[model samples]
Target chain A: MTAAVEIAGITKRFGEVVAVDNIDLQIDDGEFFAMLGPSGCGKTTTLRMIAGLEFPTEGSLKIFGNEVGTLPPNKRPVNTVFQNYALFPHMSVRDNVSFGLRMQGTTKSEANRRAGELIELVQLTGLESRKPGQLSGGQQQRVALARALVNKPKVLLLDEPLGALDLKLRQEMQNELKSLQRELGVSFVFVTHDQEEALTMSDRIAVMDKGKLLQVGTAEELYERPLNRFVADFIGQTNLLDATVADDDMIVLGNGTKIKAPNPHSPGTKVAMSLRPEAIEIGRRGDVPADHVATSLNGVVSAMNYLGHSLVYQVKIDWIDLEVRTDPVASEDRLGPGDDVSIWWDRTADWVVPDE
Target chain B: MSGVITPRGASRTLLSINSLLVFLFFYAPIILLIIFSFSDNRNVGVWGGFTLDWYGEFADSQPTRKALWNSIQIAVASTIVSVVLGTLGALALERFTFRGKQVFDALLYLPIIIPDVTMAVMMLLFFAELAGVLGLSKGFATITLSHIAFSISFVSVVVRARIAGMDERLEEAAMDLYASRWQAFRYVTLPLIMPGILGGGLLALTLSLDDVVITQFVAGPGWTTLPVFVFGLIRKGVTPLINAVSVVMLLASMALVALSLFVQRVRTTDSA
Candidate 1:
């Protein structure tokens, strides 16, 4: 697969503040790639550099294998859907969509004709004469989308495009945007602070922190196998256990339970064993054991929560607290506070990292 | 302007009274000056049964006519120059950040606060030496310079306020739509800022036209602006012709302000 955008060693600075450090990246043709990070982490800046709105201070950006280092934003073959919709306040919906065509010196008739077609595509067919202020926020977003998409550029950049919408509208827009990308088949570089949004929309996600790209991978890879504690914590919830590697495949935790993990480690090395809440099981058993690959500990259910789709139980064993998903609809064996049970898990469920 | 109110009776009467007082305070003298303009009598108090005598006097005299024409010329020239430079300056100030920005803005606004008399004296001295070296006289050149210098601050302030109120993200949005900076300015920034530029230009035009103190110091033998001409007329005695000119000035100002208010309302309704 040929890459459409190759961002090689891109670095941008605002005086002493380094907004984007030297970054090397490539985006495939017609793929939806998301740059995910917290605010001020340089994800938006990186998107700007890629769009040519910002020139990287110390590196190169290539579009379709052409070195576009000194190209102005208008010269770049990318369009952006801004976060706040930024629909031209003075222009009618149709004129707003036709703006890019007009700039390219297309005939007025042709521009209007094309804009009308694009407007329909975005499902804003009748609201043509209305100015941006007349429309609701969601409607404004659609108009913004139509305006940018009308140009049919090589790539489209959306900077948290759904950020201004209510939660329900945002979820609806996320699905629409995903489907739109699929239908258009244009390379898309999206920037968002929302990890869940990135997970839902991205073909690949690049997680950045403090001007550095921490890890870039598929959502599944990043979710199931994060590169570090930061990526692990950022992507999803993980219960980090303080433990020591007793030997290869075995970790003797501080609470006197020895658990087995698949990864090999040196003996006596301190580690943080990451256990996904779904990994642990809550059940009552007369016999309980602790071993390398499979382990069990006797505990009492400290709390029980019905989580719509699943039941969650907080179990206190000896001294340590463990969270487990229990049977949600078990009438006879409903776990509650002070109910004794054994919490167990398969070794495959946890990822162990050297904490110290 | 409304006379009726729903359970509010004396409040509206008070409002009308306040409005009338404000109008009377500002415009009564201008109306008097206009009435006096038609008086044929040398004494402005007694309107000698309505005559076009002062208008005739004002128009027939070559020097007075030339001075008025010269003022118009200066206002047009100064307005065009100040507007272009001031608009661009406002754009640059809004778009970029550099060192001494606060100082720069303060310096721009300084002329408005400084005493005009001091500026005239200082500029006169500066121009006198420069003119001597250049072997040229200060009249059109000096007055034009003063008007432009003073008008730039007004123009810049208005344009800056207009630009600052604009949503900055709109430019980024334009860029996202593959628009060049120039295109964005042409389609977006220029249209939005046109009102401020026009408004500022009108203010500068009015200022340049009516100025007396600065024009007195700067006028050469060949160049006598309308204000200077009017001042000379006043020195002779308070003629009704001066009143005539004053009324015309007042009318022009009213027209300009009305246009601005109308434009502002339309813009609000059209956009919002």
Candidate 2:
């Protein structure tokens, strides 16, 4: 089947500054896709190009095999939930939701009937006559969602839709949005700076930085094996150690400890190794089994942070410091600062990434 | 002593007295004018008894009626032309950036910045040149044109302020919902900025009605607005008829201003 959105060599330039550089992507039908990046990373710009709100300076954008690169936003078979909701303040909730239908020449009664169903879908039945100004922020967000979804476009473009909500409300909306996308079975192109939100909601995420698509993969693929240093640092908390390839299945850490891991690069080539804090097991020396240890090092605990479920210990070994997360309930001994501990991980725990 | 604050009650009393004095100073002449307008006496400020004779005379006077009609015509005509042009100008300045935008912006403010006498003189010369070349004599057209010229600035200034506070994303939202560019403007932007347009139109009407200096300079023979006619009447002599006319003009302008304020209040509440 053809992709819902096929962006080929898309690049958007505002005068001299390239907001979205040449990047190619394919979002599958009914797929929950997210473009994840920091602010000014061109994620929003890429989404706008898909929605036809901003035309790419150089690109061939196709929606279901139809060329829509220079098409106006109104002509595109897509809808956008803007960052700020952008509901018409003068319009009632019903009118706002029914606007797209009305614009398409649907009769008022027909539009309202369809809008009523959507309002109920978003759980805003009684607020049909109330203006956007009268609704709370979360309610306004729902109205924005309903407004965009009422059109039933092939792809729904959401630009940081939950960025305005409070943390608890945001989490609630995040679950709602994920389920809503599932229920509708429409492609969703969500743009967000929050990595956790992207990881939790998106089926496949395109991580972007400096107007470039750095990597595109599943949550597990990205977190487990990031291609470069930037992807490893961005996805989640991980210790990226500067190392050099020593053998086919080994790498040397800065402290000269040989770690047993897959090294894609040639020998003597400098590389970076990503080790998740949870992957590293910390205990007293000689407590861990010798067979389970791929590499082990003795370190002194410099600091500890209690995170309710787990304790993150900053372990200092020679000149290198590694963060080791341990489940407080599983471990009998409570480690503190200045305690001598051994940190070890399985061979599969560490992945080698290019230093760039 | 320097750090000590004034007592609340004492400061309140002082502020009340100052407010009373200021109000009295401003309204005393207007109140006297209104009261004397109802007087039966022929001489100014002398009350023989309460009577509606001056108002009757004002209604009966053909020249005064003609002047009033002329003022209304000029005000309405100028208001319509100015509001349209000014709204377009404001949208251009606020929504787009083009070559020489800064110069155009500065020029839009010139009419509002210059003194009335200076503007009047400049308009007089402009109309004189137009009359010489285009055979367009200064009359109703000149007065209306000059009013539109000055009123455009005021209307645009008010409209630009409204546009500035508005969110541009609303227009984008409209377009994203399948509205064409013109449709988005009509259904979304126009309705949103309507209060400003109404306010600006009222302001232009009020300014056109109240104008005397510019009207006098541009008006040809037998083409006098009420204010200009009133100014001419004042030169001949102040009469009870003048007071009645002044009261009527004052009340009409006040009503327009009140309506403008009402429109603004509705906008604030609607947006809030």
Candidate 3:
């Protein structure tokens, strides 16, 4: 399928600050794509540029198959649901939904009829005559969504649409949005600072930081095989340790502990290893299962937290804080602070992340 | 705790007394004027039996009628001009950034702060200086122009505040929904700022109708406004006719202020 939105070498500069550095990205047709980043990481800026609200300083942007670099927002074949759900205060829900049609010179009756259908589609039928302020936050968000979707643009851009909702409501809306995009079969480019929301909804995710695209892949791919230190640390909780390559399948940590890893670097080459906390097993040195213990490090528990279903232990070994999470049921002994313990993980669990 | 009033209770009482005093200070004179306008006797401030003779006399007097018409014409003209200029000024200041913005903002407030007598003198001198070059003379045009000069500032201040409170994202939302630049402003921004525009226009009308000092300096020959004519009447000594006219002017201004407030409330509720 042809790409719905293709951005090539787009760069946006505001005086001296480079808001969006040169970047190339594409959204496949009917794909649910997400741009994930921290605040001020240029994710929102990239979305705005594709929506034609911000002009790119360099490079070209195409929507579907048309070059839309210089086109104004009104001329673009895209609609955006803003982060604040910017509903028109002065218009009724029906009028707000019909606004795009009216602007397109559709007859009043036809516009109203189509808007009525859309309102019902968004499940807002009884409150059509009410203004925006008369509705709750969720209702207002639904109206914003209905208003944008009524135009039936080829692509829909959402800038943190669920950011304002509570956790439960956000989860509910995330599912609804995913189903809605699936039903419409239109490309959706969602921008959010939320890692879980992106992972739960997107077909593919783009990790960005400091005006740079770090990596892009499926949720599992990015989590399991992060390309750099930033992506490795950002996707999920992990313990990063400074290390140097020892041999073909081994690396030495700063604390002089040798660990088995698939090191692709030359011997003595400095590297950073990312070990997921959940991947590590914690127990007394000889109590652990022999087959499960690929590499074991003896340590004393500095702190331990009982988290209902699991226990998290912060093991101190030569000034390194190695976090190990173990299911409470699996570990027969109750570990506490100041207790001697051992941490072990499989050889395949430690992945080498790029240092720079 | 048993003997002392709570801070909230004490503040409430103080606020009530202060509000009462303010109401009396502002409404006492207007109430007296309305009551005296209905008095049978011609002597001022002393109430006789109820009568409608002064109103009848006011309706029959040609000079007062002409002066009222002239006041209405000038106030309407100046208010229209002021509304346009003020709305533009508010949009310019609120929607764009440029050099000397702070200086321009300070200048917008200057007309409101300068003494009316000084403004009148300044306007007189300005028109006098331009008379030879532009054939500008003191008449209906001069009075209307001077009223507009001060009214624009009031309008801009009110409208600028309204615009500042508004979210610019509303316009961007409109554009995102396929509205052009003009359509976005016309549908979203204009309706949002309408209350401020109406308020400023009514204030301009009230100020122009109530103006006496500026009118005295700028109004020539028979182009006397109601307030200027009334000031001339007061100098000769207060009359029943003067009280009647003053009551009418008060009612007119009150009606305007009431209308503006009503419109504002309706707009707010509609949006809300």
Q: By DockQ, who's the top model here?
A: 3
Name the 10 consecutive residues with the lowest summed lDDT in model 3 chain B.
B1-10
Give candidate 3 regions above 4 Å deviation. A245-250, A256-258, A265-270, A286-296, A306-308, A330-336, B1-24, B40-42, B46-51
Candidate 3 lDDT by residue in tens digits, A7-77:
89999998999988998998899999999999999999999999989999999999887999989999998
- Model 3 residue A124 lDDT? 92
- TM-scores of the candidates in the order shown: 0.91, 0.95, 0.93
Residue B16 CA displacement from its true place in model 1, Å: 4.7
DockQ value of candidate 1 = 0.62
CA lDDT for candidate 2? 0.92
In order, the candidates keep a fraction of the true contacts of 0.66, 0.77, 0.85
lDDT string for model 2 (A135-206, tens) is 999999999999999999999999999999999999999999999999999999999999999999999999
> Across residues B161-271, which tens digit of lDDT does each residue of candidate 1 receive?
999999888887776666778788888888777788878888888888878888788788888888788788888888787887766667767887898889878986876
Best by lDDT: 2
Q: Clashing residue pairs, candidate 1?
A: A80-B176, A260-A292
Worst 10 residues of 3 chain A by lDDT: A285-294
Candidate 2: RMSD to truth: 3.0
Tell me how far the alpha carbon of residue B186 in candidate 3 is from the true structure, in angstroms, after superposition. Answer: 1.0
Give the per-residue lDDT of model 1 (tens digit) for A1-356. 55788988889999999999988899999999999999999999998887777888998888888888878778878888888977888899999999988888889999999999999998989999999988999999999898989999898889999889999999998999999999999988899999999999999999999999888999999888776666776887666778888888778888878776656679888777777778776667544444522666678888888888889888887767877775477666686798878777776667777673
